[model samples]
Target: MEIPTELSSYIRVLKLASTPSWEEFSQVAKIAGAGILLVGMIGFLIFAIMSFIPGA
Candidate 1:
């Protein structure tokens, strides 16, 4: 697309979007953190199991 068109589209999006409330941001942050921790725990569990195997 042309630069002018792209710039206009970006401006339109910015005009339509609003900043998230503090509570909304906090809730999303908590959910994202929980997901990261859960993935880390699963990876660690897999590593632990592999280390215990005979030839893994």
Candidate 2:
């Protein structure tokens, strides 16, 4: 049995997408975590400020 060229190319892409090195994954995860934390902190600050302003 033989795979066609197009099918082989698709399989190669799938394989690459499914596997990533640990360092690459960790770096992405760290960036995502920092972004989430920053957003959360900003939201908390806004809420705190609104509470103090009394009319907002």
Candidate 3:
């Protein structure tokens, strides 16, 4: 008996999703936090610069 191609692919996806590794999750979380911090710093700088400008 042979398995169909579609069935094999589905099984492969299920096997991959069955495990949730903590190391990978933490790496993703750290990158996301750094990105948020960078965006916040940029916004603060823009606000400070605008405050010093003359009236429009």
Candidate 4:
């Protein structure tokens, strides 16, 4: 008897879902909100400079 080449044994991975603990949730959310605010401020500063261009 001969075994097929594709029949080799392999480890299988399992997928699982999880809910974040309270500390994990709050830390992640606050960091994300802070990032958005920081980006917005930087964008506003860049736009503010457009009004002062010498050619404009």
* Candidate number achieving the greatest lDDT relative to the actual structure: 1
lDDT of 2 by residue, 1-56 (tens): 45698899998999888666999999999999999999999999999999999789
Q: Listing every candidate in turn, what is its Cα RMSD in Å to the true structure after a full C-alpha superposition? A: 0.7, 5.3, 5.4, 6.9
Candidate with top TM-score is: 1
Name the candidate, 1 or 4, with the larger lDDT value: 1
Q: Write the per-residue lDDT of candidate 1 for residues 1-56, one digit (tens) a residue.
A: 69999999999999999999999999999999999999999999999999999898
| Residue-pair clashes, model 1 | 0
List candidate 3 stretches off by more than 4 Å: 1-16
Clashing pairs for predicted structure model 3, backbone only = none
- Model 4, position 23, has a per-residue lDDT of 100
Relative to the true structure, candidate 4 reaches a TM of 0.64
Please report, in order, the local distance difference test score of every candidate based on alpha carbons: 0.98, 0.92, 0.88, 0.76
How many clashes show up in model 4? 0
Indicate the TM-score of model 1. 0.94
When summed lDDT is taken over every stretch of 10 residues in candidate 1, the lowest stretch is 1-10
Mind giving the per-residue lDDT tens digits that candidate 3 earns over 1-56? 45698899989999888555899889999999999999999999999889988782
